[model samples]
Target chain A: MLTIHNLQKIYNGTTVVNLTELTITAGESVGLVGNNGAGKTTLFRMILDLIRPSKGEVLSKGTNVMQSGDWKNYTGSYLDEGFLIDYLTTEEYFKFIGDLHGLSGGDVVERLAPFTDLFNGEILNQRKYIRDYSKGNQKKIGIAAAALSNPELLILDEPFANLDPSSQIRLKNLLKKFREEKQMTMLISSHDLSHVIDVCERIVILEKGQVVQDMQTTENTLQELETYFTV
Target chain B: MLLTLLSHQWKAKLRSSIFQKSLVLNIILGLLILYFGSIFLLLGFGLHKILGNMYPGQDVVGIFNSALLFCFLIDLFFRFLMQELPVLAVQPYLHLPIAKNKLVHYVLVKSVPSIFNLFPLLVFVPFMYTSVMPAYGAAVAIVWVATLLLVTLLNNYLLMYFKRQMSTKPLYTLAFGVAIVGLMLLDYFGVLQLKAISETLFGAVLVNPWLAVVPLVLLAGTYLLNFYYLKAHTYPEELELRKTNTATGGDIAFLNRFGELGKLIELELKLIWRHKRTRSIAMMSVMFLFYGFLFYGKGKFMDGFGTLIFVGIILSGMPMFNYGQFLPGWQSGHFDGLLTQKNISPYQFYTAKYWMMVPVTVLAFILTLPYGFFGYKIILINAATLLYNVGVNVFVIFFFSVYNKERLDLSKGATFNWQGVGASKFVMMLPAMALPILIYLPFGLTGIPYAGIAALGGLGFLGIIFRKQLLQWSANRFVAHKYKLAAGYRQS
Candidate 1:
């Protein structure tokens, strides 16, 4: 349940993001596909209020994300390493996040039990600081921490990037499970077409900061998107 | 190949985002350097006159010769403090076809441009012209100047090696410190005369111009040692060994009681201890707590209440000034996490910082309580200044910190890294120093100085009383700038 209205982020006369209108309804899983400068990450940053939007506002569940702190309660985002505190160990970071969400230590332990396989035994019980973790492992830690709070709305940018093949598959399965069982709202942006098609119920393609195409997932949706992206 | 690498480095320096963003800051820094250069030039020109004034009827050249070694030793100490190893920037080139020798040579040559090497020449060259050239003739004077430059270079490379060794094993630093102090003490007592030894060695160089070869040899030796050391340890794992790793986990159970904010404070404490730059700065602040001994030991500043206030502020207020100046930049690494993932209100964050400074100020006061043994009045003055520092300077520093939008890389050493510095940092000094002086000056000028000191304490106490309101105000300020700060933090 997120809405972008007249949103524009301009940098020195260049429009970085200029979405006229975009909305993801409750319980919908959407995949954002774009070229490098398509403003996918910029849009996510505006939604999180990490950067100020130039013209309009982003609304989450009828609340202006900029004007209030209520949306952060149920919004989970992992756009980059900025989302993770690198100085802390994985467990410490999780515990701190859990405490922020008012989850007991026991609750955090139970919640993390499901990610043990996704973690591939290298993350949990590992005594290394997050800074020392490999980039792919760090990605896993960030993605896992984004969902650690059990937020109703999840946004992950390039979640499949930097991930090993097995972890990527595991992550796809996890997102599928969350989508079906919990009916969670997710907005995932990735360059990986197959994975996006595999998980998302709807697909939105962006070009030059504008939404060029929006469609519900159909049997030929993958073929249609691939053909569109073919130069 | 080396030329290409050097050109790349040149381009990197000119094209860096920091260089472009900090043009005004760099101009100010350049002006400051020019100012220091003028001072050293004045000192160089006036060397003979000053030495004659100090040691009347003595040979100024002999005096200068004796002092040369001492000056170079002090220069070495300062180089250890100020010089950064330039080799770290070569990481991107490691996979290229560049030879490791060329890279090491490039790093060593790059260090030559540092201000440290230029400084001694400014102070020494004019003296050599005015004093030695006339007396020794131009040829011998040239030899003497060449010798001095070579010795300076020798000290630079020697200390570079020592610093690199010390980084790998701190025991080398301890041993070096012990050796230096031992020599100083040996010279302080009549056991050994460093002045006499320096006089003999350098004075001999003046007499025999050929003796310049000795310093030349020493310089070459040190340069080769550093060259080979770099060659031997060019690999990433070997370089990683050079960094000292301490225990990562430290539990502060007391912090657990404060809930999420407490956890943040605990995390801040861990950040300070775990990082080299922060840990060293924090330790240096603590070391400065004993700095009162420098003035108080000599029985100076006894009645100068203004001086006492300065000491008190230096003792108690410096940690806040030094550490608080960075503020959220210190959290730049995880600032986005702080903003989006957590439900932390700006008010709670500011309050946590306020509480964190309280203990530091209190600890400072406790440490200075012994100064009260010097005089009950000294204790009273310190207590008042302590309160002023905690109450007023804390908030003032925090207020100024909001303007410091530049992000800091926490892992970088603090000595010369100017990542978070801007015009705001310079402006911050105005309130920190002038406000306290403004508050105290009127009382001293009036007949009753003690009352003025007490008035300062009263103001500080009022600040403490209304801290909640002040924190609320600070929190509101933080919230207003939150987006701008978050964007700045994300840049790096």
Candidate 2:
């Protein structure tokens, strides 16, 4: 479970994020929707502690994640390639991240075994470094490595942007399966409303640093969510 | 459109926080020195004497015209060698509505106004004016010089545009080396009769002043030619085309000699190789050989067996010994990975460095031997000195990193640092030379003649032979000062 209480972020002396009292429980899937500059990415980064919040706490269960009190050892994220080291091979990178999370190399290989040949094993011995990987392939690799951790909390920012439609659908299904199997909690942000609609159960609409609407997907179409987005 | 692109490029560079602060300070200091020093040096006593000796019978106008042409050509040579393609600004416009040819033209035109184009003209014009034009009218003098400036700008821009497109280090090296050799050969042959050329060229400054238009025509033709080449090959971001697919591990036959230490040395060498600018250090490794030649020859300016032996050690060991002076910064990006590895011993790292220097020093001594025309004793001393670098200097310098403050720009021109290299290694050399003398001096004077030299050579040989102990001990000291090392890595 994650809780963001009175979270605020300022940029160049102006408050860009000012959300108040948001929470999601374990196994819950949340779609964060906002127009450009509506602070979805900023909120995710503050939660991951990549950036410090201007005010208030990003809490996991009862502990403040921001104070360096406890890392969501359970959290895996790719806000951008900042989480990935490009010098590494896709396999080397996944193994290194797995090691960081205290998984053995064998354990990582076992988890990745099912999907290793999915990209025609073109990736495994491709000898192509991450920097040379196509934009979509890089996204796939980052997302795959994040999922490889079997994290309790997985957060992805703009996961569908560079992905081909098939990969996008495949990723949505995988997220669904992971949430069902491990009861994982996830926060995914995307500008493409349909990807969010197809995958996410509950939607939290943000506009100008405000959590303007929290609605069940069955109750409204994505178009109904836009009134909340208007500045 | 071209002006807008140029302005945008200028403003973008100016707005970059790092670029603005650093470049402004760098430019201001450079301009101040260039302006003041040129004036002072122009006023210095050597000018009239130097010009007079060089051009005995030639009138000043002939001298001035030739000098201007010569400087304009020099300016073009430099622009080819040193100019940077502003690749970043061109990227965004590539997919825009603008025609690629037009964009390329804008880039080529924009390059003409760079600071480098102005430098030679500044140095030549005023000095030539006062020195050369006393016999000519101001109208003829001013117009002739303006023609020179126009030609310099025109040709300089064109040559650079082509060279920038074909930029490769080895090509530059070969061309530059050949150019230098040609210039030297020309001087040595005394075939050009430069004094006459100087006199005629300056004299031509006065007679009708019409011939000065020739350099301008050459400039315009070359610029048009450059624009054609640039348009055909406008690979926008090619300027930033740093190769990332650097072949790791030893595929080369010579690298197999090093074993694992060889692999590491290979990796380090590859880093130097791939980054062409960084290899300036290795090339400079060759320059270090010249120090002995400066002091060692029998009829040379400063001949001494001891000085030659001393320079021998210096030429070989100084760079590697000096390298650790910027201890942490070289290891900056990989510090987290390197530090967390509890498996590899620090001595492994230290010894690998020694192995790298072994070949470095072998090359250094072999290069230094031509200077051994002084004696075979010098060759023997030089070999002993190479071994000495492997032993004593390598040990102390690794630990010298503990107090070192230089966080070298690993990304910058690797061979040179104008800010200043550290003094610890240099200070350490005083004792490296003198302490062995302490052991050698009393024994040589009182008992066996040349005993001091033998003892020093013996100690150097043994130190290299017993380098394991030296490496082991330094590793411990380094571990103890690990915090400082970490801090140093972050500094660069």
Candidate 3:
């Protein structure tokens, strides 16, 4: 459903991202691996239309995402904390997003029904202003909101870092369940190759803003990815 | 090292547009303050004109002494309140194989060139030179001015030492705010009996110029005591936890009162309270009030100027003053989550903001009401002005919220204004000024008190009638300006 062709970005007169062509079919779970500042975020921004690329276009379902009203509805992202409004409680935060996606409160609760215990009264009526929340708690609330929209595309940046191991596993399972139920497309980026290796159908390694390798996760596994990372 | 510190101070001063503007404006403004100050001296001139010659106590030295005490109080207050104690410069030397006391002394020395020290001299010297110089001769005027400076400096040094001790205590922010406000109120209401005190002090200074040295002993005593406190209580943890707990008192109170809005307001309040810069609402208000005093008290004017002063004093402190100036950037970190999920309308967002501004406007009114003793009808005008402040001014500017966008980093020094305040304040002042004129002009010309009352009611009713439309317009305007405001706050 997502497509990128010759997506080039330049900063300070030097190219940071120059993705010649890339596409993921609807519902496909694709993983992007990259060096730090390898233009993964720039790519993500292109996909979200947060920043402009110097050339080329990113399209979702044959429509250019940068120009499409449908893109905001179909896509969910957690890449920028500046995108977060600290004045809101987690509950109000979730409610605002769901409303934007035209989801009813009941639908939101039904969606959240499974994760109540995991959140552990830690987030309920957790009226603590998000500004006062710990980084991990903010991460928990952000991840929870992303899944609440039940969108066709979900993109996460370093989603596993602040999360506890158990919650990370739970997120993996939730992503799995969503993929099976809705055939949702996921673009996930992370430093922990092992975490994505088990979940992604295909892996693409990005080094310095260009794809160095693209292969099936079945072929690389965590060990091969580890070897690639170390080398 | 001293030169480096002074140059750093100058660099910091030069970098600020406000400081630069003030220096330029003050040259013009200084002449005005001095020229107007001469009028007070001309009260003695008027006395000279009236009683055939210079009568004892015929001049406005009473005003000068009153103003001098004002200078004294300001220096003392800043010495207590400002945390720019130059501890950072010496932070590099803390590891230098130097004794802590020597390091502390260096920090203390660095504080003398502060903006606080400059203000008194700017104020007193001009008045002394213009008023007393020709009358008493330049040498006597110079002595009088220096005597006043030493008095202010001695108080400043003592307060600095006092702050050294209090920084060790709990609830220092709250205590500092309370003490300053209390002291200011005492001075403001003239309960300090300033007119008599000044005459006595000037009489003393005239006889024995060396008597000014008595305050120096007190200054030295305070400095030594404070130096000892800093030396003995140099540990970090002594004052840390108290401030942390002190911040929570407002949080709980706000949460209890505001309900959900209270929760949001509490977040906003805590943001301001935590960041000394955001808490500068009081400072901004006082500045507005102080500005009004300069224009109002500088002249003995009729009702319209009084109305302007009254409104100026009250409305200048709109709670939303700088808080909502940045619109949504105050929510920078968590906005994504709020944007992504749940369901909040633009109305709810703007509603919370309107509610927050209410108390500040109310407090501003209460503060201005005392000027009624100057004239009771002026009090009525101020009360009418309060309604106009709310209905015409406060509401109109709520819609203007997008323009003057400055995201205050609460942690930044109140003086550190990197956040670029856009042209909204300049634009907003037009409607705030114009609407009041329109509302009052017809009634004002008639001199019918009821007409003024009717004008106020009519304006408020109009605001209430159109509040929904204004809010809708505000929401749309804010949404449009979101990205611009957001980028600006982050940049600042």
Candidate 4:
């Protein structure tokens, strides 16, 4: 569960993110939809405690994220390529993350099993550094590593942007399975409406760093979102 | 078109982050160039007289002629190590409507004004004015200077061609180095008459200016070689000196025993080994271990505590200073990943860096132990400085580490690189090097210098004892500054 209270981020007198209050309960999956410069990534960064908020605080389970680092223990996040160590081989990076989470080598391989389809056999055993991988492959590696620990809350930004259509659909299915089996709380931001609607039980449409709509997913939710975004 | 390209290159240099962000660094770089330039000019004017005195009865001109070949050879070796290939600058122009021939000419001609080509002229032109004009008439002197410049350009193009041809084969470079050394040794042992041959060849040019055509033709040949090579391989990846090979190094099995700390150290070592810039810094640190010889062998420095302590600090601490000045910045590429990782407390991160540097400092101290052969006193001072560096100076680096927010592009070579190097680095070095000497200065002035040396070591011993507290303090500072650092890195 995560909460934001009066969170505001401003640069050079221009507000990037301004939220009076927002909260996500346990077992809830929320998709953040926004266009470019909608402050989606900036809001995510504040929640992750990577960037200090200009006003108010982000709370992970009632503890201020900035005042404590305990949220990192149960929060799995992959916002961008910055989350991935590019110099390490895919296996090495996985092993490193697994080691941090006290996972055995076998546990690492087992957890990565779910990613096999999405990986398309191009990730592991490539014998090249992550930096040398194509953009799509690098995103896959970041996503898989973020999920390797099976953290309580998952945060990913633009998870389907660089991925091919096939991988994107596979990823959507993977997310659905994780939510169904483990009740993993997810906060995914994407420009893809249908894919986000398919995986998330709720949708929060954001504009200019403020939430415009927060509604439970329905059969007509996709049509409603498409109509809202028409202009 | 060429002018537009040149102006673009000029703008690139002027607007680069390293240049625009730090006026202090730019001034320091300018001063260094001026210092070296003045020194070369003075040597150029004074060389003929120095040679005349060394070989009293011999012709000064002949002596200069004899050394020309050796100078050129040494110059070539240095150029091989430091000269950057200008191939990548031509990449953006490749798909444009520009003529391929004009672009190739720009790449080849761009190398002519580099420090490797121009610095020698500082010496040669002055020597030509002072000595050659007096000995050989004005025409001959003019011809001789032209010949030298031709040979210099020839070496430039020759390196570009050979380096491109043998880019992937390091063995050829090694063989070339060995052959040069072998030639020098043969000349030293009198198995070859290089000096005589050099004298005759240059002496011939003095008599007949027309023979300058030899070097002229060779220069043209090498230029054409580089021209055709660039003409054929204008593709950016083909022109790249080192094609991205599969990652070579793997995890250090032994380091895994230390658990998370070991993982951090293993990652840092891999970073050093994999990147060109970090690898060169490592190599430079090794080279600097010989720094002790400069001070230790001199009797005046032997009698003094300040100079010897300075040398001791540099000898054992050069690696830490060179690498640590950019602490956390080296990890700036993946800093966000590091911050959000589970169970990687800032305390553990700093502790890992502390432990990693201690062993290297100890290793450097052991390697420089032979400096004790110079005198037991030398060993005493170095041992004290080593302790000081490990304890006090390491913390000094850690304290200043938070200010290093610039993101490093590790792929580039370290030579002439100023990326991630801010004015704070120069500021940080002042206290790290000078504080130890400051600690000793009072005792030396009081004429009880041994106590001063012991005090330096004693302070270091205290720091080592309280290292936990110091590391925790550093972590606290890092936590306070992490947002700023993250923002800076994200911008780039």
> Which regions of candidate 1 deviate over 4 angstroms?
A1-231, B169-173, B240-247, B297-300
Model 2 segments beyond 4 Å from truth?
A1-231, B1-40, B43-46, B53-86, B92-119, B167-202, B227-234, B237-249, B252-262, B290-300, B304-310, B318-328, B375-384, B402-459, B481-492
> Who wins the DockQ comparison?
2
Please tell me how candidate 4 rates in CAPRI terms: incorrect
Q: Per-residue lDDT of A79-178 in model 1, one digit per residue for the tens?
A: 8776665656788778767766788999999988878888999998888668668889999998888887888899999999999999999999999988
Runs off by more than 4 Å, candidate 4: A1-231
Instruction: Summarize candidate 1's per-residue lDDT along B1-492 as a digit string, tens digits.
Output: 556556656655665556667877899878999999999999999999999999999988899999877778778778877787675566544422234577789878877766887788997789989998898898998899888888888888888887888767789867876787787788889798889999999889889999999999999998999999887666443454334464778799999999988987888888887876787679778878888887774555785788878887787787888898888788888888887766688888888888888898898788778877777877887888888988888899879767877877777678777777877887887788777877888878987788888888898999999999999999899888888898888775
Q: Which candidate gets the maximum TM-score versus the true structure?
A: 4
> On a 0 to 100 scale, what is the lDDT of residue B38 in model 1?
97
Error of 1 at B69 (Å): 1.7
Candidate 2 lDDT over residue span B253-293, tens digit each: 68678676666666666656654445666666656667665
- Give the alpha carbon lDDT tens digit for every residue of A1-231 in model 2: 898899999876878899789999888989999888889988887786555577988888768864442444677777776555564577776765676567898898887765543343556767756756777787878777777778888889999898777777777777777778788888999987877877788898888889878888874667786555555
lDDT of 3 by residue, B1-492 (tens): 445435434554454444343344536545766776665455444532443344455565545564456556665666665635543343222211234566556656666665566555655666666567767777777778778766766776666655644555536545765876786687669787655666678656755767766766766776676667655543333312224333344436635675666666666666656655666754665666544454343344644543553454245345445554555655654554545445455665676666667667767767766665556655565666665655556566666766644444544555535444444555665665666666556666777645866677567667656777877777787778767766645433
- Alpha-carbon runs more than 4 Å astray in model 3: A1-231, B15-89, B96-102, B122-148, B169-221, B226-228, B231-242, B250-263, B269-317, B320-342, B358-392, B412-423, B442-456
Return the TM-score for candidate 1, rounded to 2 decimals.
Answer: 0.68
Docking class of 3: incorrect
Answer with 2 or 3, whichever has the higher DockQ: 2
| Per-residue accuracy of model 4 over B1-492 as CA lDDT, tens digit each | 567556556655665657877888889999999999999999999998899899999888889999888888887788878888886776434322346677788888778878888888999999999999998889999999999999999889888887777775668767777888888888999998889989999989999999999999999998988888777666555678877676989889999999999998998999899889999999999999988777887889887889999999999999999999999899889999999999799999999999999999999999999989889998899899989998899999999999998989998998889898878998999999999999999999999999999999999999999999999999999999999988777645
| TM-score for each of the candidates | 0.68, 0.57, 0.51, 0.69
Indicate the residue-level lDDT of B403 in model 4.
95
Q: What's each prediction's clash count?
A: 0, 8, 24, 0
